[model samples]
Target: MPSLMDTYIENREMVQPNHANNLDTVHGGNVMKWMDEVGAMSAIRFAGKSCVTARVDEMDFRRPVLVGDTAVIESYVYEAGETSVDVYLRAFRENPRTGERELTTESYFVYVGIDESGEPSPVPALTVESEEGERRQAEALDGLDA
Candidate 1:
């Protein structure tokens, strides 16, 4: 089983023209798609099996990620059950010129492991055995309200 940090997956993509709205800010749907993809990556890495999105507990856009800015997505496994894993996803806007980044979105996603037959299956235990890992897991679970 992958540990806390080891189960993390990230992706940084540029906000293209089609990814923006009339105001030139990244579209909310596009951000949600990115978050779902990155969260799936973490879930797959942790469970080592095919998984499906069971539910999105909450997704809230704190700020807009503008076009030309790098959309940095960070995701990790926070909790796991017999056949489900909870993932915490965060999106940030990275300025190309200053190389600074700021949080823009946050959400918690749940995925269920699937077997070769496409049926839900149990996943292995997760290891959150470090100080930072424990803190992050706790922080992610602080408020499911998003």
Candidate 2:
């Protein structure tokens, strides 16, 4: 079994001109790409094998990340089936100068583990051994109802 903590992943990307839209804010597509990459990392950590995106449960961009801000994406595996890992992912817009951050987006991503032959493979069971992990898992489960 792999604990939720073991599957945790966080990444940061600086929003540059190339990643921005007409409003000089980070594009939604770029944010989605970042979420997918971070979510896949968490899934791979949990499954210990190559993983591919199976589904995106939902993606909501509540706020925009400005061109000068840093986009921080955090991800963790909350549950797993035989070949599927469900990951909770969230992004924040962070000000580098002030260290202030605000929630920018959130999404749930499902990944399927694959073997060397590129076929579906079983993933390890997810364990919420820590109280924090349990709380996170609970939150993720609750979000599925919304």
Candidate 3:
């Protein structure tokens, strides 16, 4: 079994011109792609196998990440089923120099572990062992209703 915190992963991407729109804000698609990549990493960590995205719950863009800002993507496995891992992801726009950050986007993703032949494989159960892990799991579950 893997503890929920053990599956946590964070990635950062600079919002270069190529990744942004004419308005100078990072594109919505690019944000989603980053979230998916981080979420998959968390799932793979929990499952110890390759994982494919099964579903993406509603995504809400709270703010925009400017071209010069850093997009920090964070993800963790909060729950797991027989062959699936449920990950919660959050994206923040950060000012590199000041270290200030603001939430830009958030979503829930489900990934299914895969075997060598690409068939669904069983995943280890997720354990919320620490207070931080329990709090994160609670927050993710609560967010589902919003």
**Candidate 3 Cα outliers beyond 4 Å, as residue runs:** none
Query: Which pairs, if any, clash in model 1?
Result: none
lDDT of 1 by residue, 1-146 (tens): 67988877889989999999999999998999999999999999999998899999667789999999999999999989999989999999999889899999998999999999999999989898889899888889785643
lDDT (tens digit, per residue) of candidate 3 on 35-117: 99999999998999999999999899999999999999999998889999999999999998898999999999999999999
Model 1: how far residue 45 lies from native, Å:
0.4
Residue 60, model 1: Cα distance from true site in angstroms: 0.9
Tell me each candidate's TM-score. 0.95, 0.97, 0.98
List per-prediction Cα lDDT, in the order shown. Answer: 0.91, 0.94, 0.95
Q: Every model's Cα RMSD, please? A: 1.3, 0.8, 0.6
Worst 10 residues of 3 by lDDT: 137-146
Error at 119, model 3, angstroms: 0.6
The best-first sequence of candidates by TM-score reads 3, 2, 1
